[model samples]
Target chain A: MRNIIIPAVLFILVITFVALNLFYITDNASRLDAILVSASDAAKNGDFEEATAEVERFKEEFSAVGKYLFAVIQHNEVDDVIFSSNRLLALCNADTKEQFLSEIEVTRESIKLIRDAEIPYLENIL
Target chain B: MAVAVIRTVILYIIIVFAVRVTGKRQIGQLSPTELVITLMLSELAVLPMEDMQKPLLAGVIPIFVLVIVEFFVSAVVLKSIRLRRILNGRPMPIIENGRINQQNMKKIKLSLDELAEELRILGSYDIETVSEAVMETNGQMSIVLKEDYEPLCKDNMKAKKEERKVPAVVISDGEIQKEGLLKAGIDKEQLKSILQKNGCSSAKEVFYMTSKAKNSYFIVKKEKKQ
Candidate 1:
């Protein structure tokens, strides 16, 4: 039991840090997500200014950060998604799955982000 | 153009987080059950983000739900060893002491051909090269390479009287590596003195540094243009 104390403590501490970091990133992303939803909502309602402001917020937040090869590409990707998404938001009935899929193509775009931001990092780590 | 892009960007963050939290099992190491769950989770996350008509809460809620379920399961697993084994499953020994457990392999529905392929991909050639292979809960095959297959470490790489020591990062970028200083059996003052003699006024001037059994290493940043 005594031999295991420090290892156990350190393990707990390490796990806690990882968990908290995940939580922090999730919380921040979700906050940005709320703004994103509102941006589409505004675009739907013909509120271009509001939609633009929503996107601008994300640009400002991520533009300077995560410049590592992975970060850079993924950040730009989100930039593209939000940019095109604004178009559909402005469409009266264009927010339908067909319109949204055609304009935003969220899944295909997500692969890019995953490939750029997370996959390479994972590959390196492995 | 940007607003729509940012929304997708923001949503990916959550999805990625969920992936990360789901652990490294997503990459090539997944049991059938685990793989299905992973796909289900991804689809669940994507649904809300793509369909604006879907509730705004849809995008974020399932993630929290999964996390809560994980936490609850973890708590139960912690309290009951048997329950832990049941939920998280046990590590089945597929290859025990250089012998394959055919029953275990069949139980997991892994064909011999598939097993051999996976083994070879991970660098194990034969039973001799595989001391053991354990099927992990996440469905990853953990192979402990046999003694001969294991790579030669620095200690073994060197001959007699050429003892090796692990290299340590003494500094990174323009900062004094305080922990590294202590780790290397040196002090800040000594590092600083070395920096000064090297024409660097401060630790900030040093861009990179490393140390080994021999002694120390330092790298100064390029001078700025006047």
Candidate 2:
């Protein structure tokens, strides 16, 4: 009984840890999505100052989770999203509304890629 | 940098767990399939440990999956002799009836020089004296000496044999084993009287005590260390 129970409990603890990691990845990505949307909205209305402030806020939040994200998620995708977000900030500084909106879309796509990569796919199913 | 550290630590812990799942056999003792799995698992774990970019799950998921597959395969092989033979391969008799089995030697891909070297390692320097040499599943060579070359054992000697019993540890470091006393068919009072006769004040004074037979006993006194 002890032998069976010990392994079962360890198995449950391991599953719980993996589930917690998934929950953290999704929650972090969702929170970043919200920030990106707010920044994009400010960018669209030509509110450059407001957009820059939101972008700074986004960078701060991203930095907080950046280390953990790199550890848990695919690095290249996370890197792409981060680079695009940085490019969006640069476009805001240059006051190029057209390029800023384009970079914002790229950043959004990159973020989605990171999230989707973590989701269990057909390749992972096997 | 901290993320890389965390990744390394996690991968180390997980790999340890996976290896533990695969029993405690030494690397050389593992079957061909087990060796392959172990090598692959080590390779899989390295990618995530060194490259923080790779998701921890990227390394962890596959490792756990491999462990599960290996475990399933092992369990299946246990229930089926044919599967076990196919998977782990059977021990091959390289020498039978004082003759080298060339066919089995070729099947095992062992050359004459290697076979002789293995035989020498088993203390059979000359293959001519070996009646049978088998290559065990764990890759160990087991050699059986020819009747003429075999050592004379006790059965070959006409010597008087006496009944012998395993020595029961009655007292260890001041604690008396009641069970050992019971097995020897002696009670606590008898033990105290025996200790009195032996010049030991009590069982506490003795460091080690063993009952060799129904009556024979040995006691080692506890030495004081300054």
TM-scores, each model vs. reference: 0.47, 0.52
Candidate 2 segments exceeding 4 Å error = A1-126, B158-226
For all candidates in order, the CA lDDT equals 0.62, 0.83
Residue pairs with backbone atoms closer than 3 Å in model 2 (clashes) = none
Question: For model 1, how does the per-residue alpha-carbon lDDT over A1-126 read when each residue is reduced to its tens digit?
Answer: 567999989867865654554454445455555655665566667666665676566445534332432332335555565555455444424335345434434523443443333221322221
TM-score of 2: 0.52
lDDT of 1: 0.62
What is residue A28's positional error in candidate 2, in angstroms? 25
Residues B1-226, candidate 1: write the lDDT tens digits: 1222334556678777766775565446764444655777778767754553355356567766775666566567679989867766898898988888999988889888888887887887776689889888866778998787888876687845665677667778776677778777778888777777778887777777777744556465656748
Worst 10 residues of 1 chain B by lDDT: B1-10
DockQ of all predictions against the true structure, Cα-based: 0.02, 0.05
Candidate 1: segments with Cα more than 4 A from true spot = A1-126, B1-41, B121-123, B129-131, B143-168, B182-189, B195-207, B212-214, B218-226
Fraction of native contacts (fnat) of each candidate: 0.00, 0.00
- What's the C-alpha lDDT at position B162 in model 1? 67
